[model samples]
Target: MGNCNSCPSKGNCNSDSGCSGLVPKYGKIKHIIGIISGKGGVGKSTVTGILAVQLRKLGYTVGVLDGDITGPSIPRFFGINDKRSDISQVGDGGEVKFAPVETSMGIKVMSLNLLTEEEEAPVIWRGPVITGVLKQMYSDTEWGELDYLLIDMPPGTGDIALTIMQEVPLEGMVIVSTPQEMVSMIVKKVVIMAKKMNVNIVGVVENMSYVICGKCGEKIRVFSKKTAEEQAEYLGLPLLAEMPINLDLVESMENGNVEDYVSKSEEYEVLLDNFKNKIGI
Candidate 1:
């Protein structure tokens, strides 16, 4: 109510805000969190997939909204690349609704790739069209009852990111970054944008922070001397997890078996705990 800077209604809203009405009408989504980054190639989608898988592992109903329209990869990661969503008519007005595709682990996923004829097809639409499609995907999808719906945001503070921040009723955001100083610097821009938009940041996850030696079981910080702890301290956010590069996990992702990796990885168990604590769930 202070300035209404972050409100979807902007300058037109009063104390009796109706911002919650902006959310999708068909689902009882308890939490809608965005996984975001300022720079690309920081494994933002990977973090999103991991968080969804971990939340699902705890018997919570979850959904993943692939907001990266141009480079949608959530469906592929969940092994639903070949699957297509079904549409149905609802209500007296006959509103069209989309049914999200379910993974083997029962996590719901909605992505532009799922609706496209080819998985590799490029989304070459303009900014307005892309944002419109994203908004429709969120509001028109029948997500059912979900404990968590993670929005895998596109890289940078572009139109899609700004649109989602303003329109979506996000509970919070999870920032993903890397060990590189340049990457951390770029990620801070996203933090600033989120703060200005009044979006709550849950924490930061450092992906590909280090690698373990296969021969002797030693940690190798090959990417940079700068650590996630330093980056988090600089950004004044909690360091959720310093995720190591595991060839096995990478292979599983490549083969569309992320759920399998989440099921068997002890490291993911720790990450799940950290995420739970940070999100206070």
Candidate 2:
């Protein structure tokens, strides 16, 4: 047998085996894709939920591991609240594991908000503790078998984001951004960070790329800012999808039924198809 300690791949080998903090037994995940952004309010979680639901529609088992410990909205967006992870003994000698809560569409979900008493309660945790929780969500939670696990990552290149990039065996990422150029700078940093971590980027998805006029139905660029196409070109990746601002989606999110929104949106149908082709899913 070749000595893994002396091999030159530097622990980045393409193998099915899991590492120390991540074990295949917890999930045996086929792909781990993160939905990330450069800053907040770009609808990262919205894209995450839409992708998970859409992927499920394509007949693949899916799950979502909310990596945003302090700012967890994946649960709320899916109308999941007041639910805690079920604990069970995995084997002998008192080894316990937390099971991810299943959504209405049977998508496994785990998040800090689900564990907390109140959804509005502040996490108030340090960086390392938060990162530890993110790790435990994968290691300690029983995600079972899934074709794809979409991680709803928090905004910015912070400690938790770095932890996910470094610790999790990310297959690729879907970078979400708005039309603003200021936000593009942060998105560029995220791209650089992903490359540094040796993670493959599936493509970019621009949310709120435009707003449709209620009276005339004319598509209008909200801020007239630089779009994701230019940034994706700069990063040398494809622009997979661009979501326009729609009132129906806004109402769905307000009512905490994002899955229904994704299913009902005709635009999402085409977007999902484009995303699948780009990611080869």
Candidate 3:
């Protein structure tokens, strides 16, 4: 039986006797990032989308593995309408394999939204089944030669989140949260969880910390006055960036085109730099 020390898998191998959930590496992936939040509606998926596009802009081959199985929105954000995952057969016995779908910006993506006939269909799956799908996507999907593979993990310290922390070979994780006391409290839980799992905490992102008034151009703290500094200090991690609430960004998300949104926004342009510097892209 292989212990953690003897395990060949460079990724998180939660099993002592070699992880049976180990996904075969089909392509060359340089870095794997997990974007997580303590709760939903903190723009975790939005950050994932922004990072993917920004990295691609910086001339890196990037892909996103939508780990949020129940509420897969990566496909929607990328504006991919393909409802089917490409397949291939291996060996004489005809073992089937799944190919990740590509976006218009040449970003590779794989999500449950593409597999389901109805995008709005509820996953309605139990814990084990959801985790099994995540492992399958990691093992079975062909994400060829990506410099960065960002995983859009579901919110909270749930089963899927734990499964990913235990399984995926995460280079690091970026925690997303708003500038609210409750949100900051929850963010700490995620940070602690990452440390316990031996996952590197890259940094924290404060989403919707404030908004710019149209008339006065003043920064308004719509959510809370808590700064990214406080959150970072709480997590004992660096504050990567603090994102303001923008109507244009909201529109982009609503239209399922965040790449376009980030390209035009001056704020995200600066964020791109901060992100690159922190993660050493």
Could you say which candidate leads in lDDT?
Answer: 1
Measured by TM-score, how close is model 3 to the native structure? 0.88
* Decreasing lDDT order of the candidates: 1, 3, 2
Q: State the displacement of the C-alpha of residue 52, model 3, in Å, after optimal TM-score superposition.
A: 0.6
RMSD of each: 4.2, 4.0, 3.6
Which candidate leads in TM-score?
1
lDDT of 3 by residue, 109-138 (tens): 989888888788899989999998888787
What overall lDDT, based on C-alpha atoms, would model 1 receive against the true structure? Answer: 0.86
Candidate 2 per-residue lDDT, tens place, 1-281, comes to: 32333222226676444243354346567778899988999999989998889998878899998988888888877888768877788779886787888988899999988777788999898898888788777777777778888899999889988887876667788999877878777888998898988878888888889988889988888765566577567656788888898788878877877787687667887668877887676
lDDT of each: 0.86, 0.80, 0.81
lDDT of 1 by residue, 144-259 (tens): 88888999999999999999888777778999998888888899999999999998899999899899999999889988887778879988799889999878887897898879
Worst lDDT run of 10 residues, candidate 2, spans 1-10
> Candidate 1 regions off by >4 Å?
1-17, 90-94
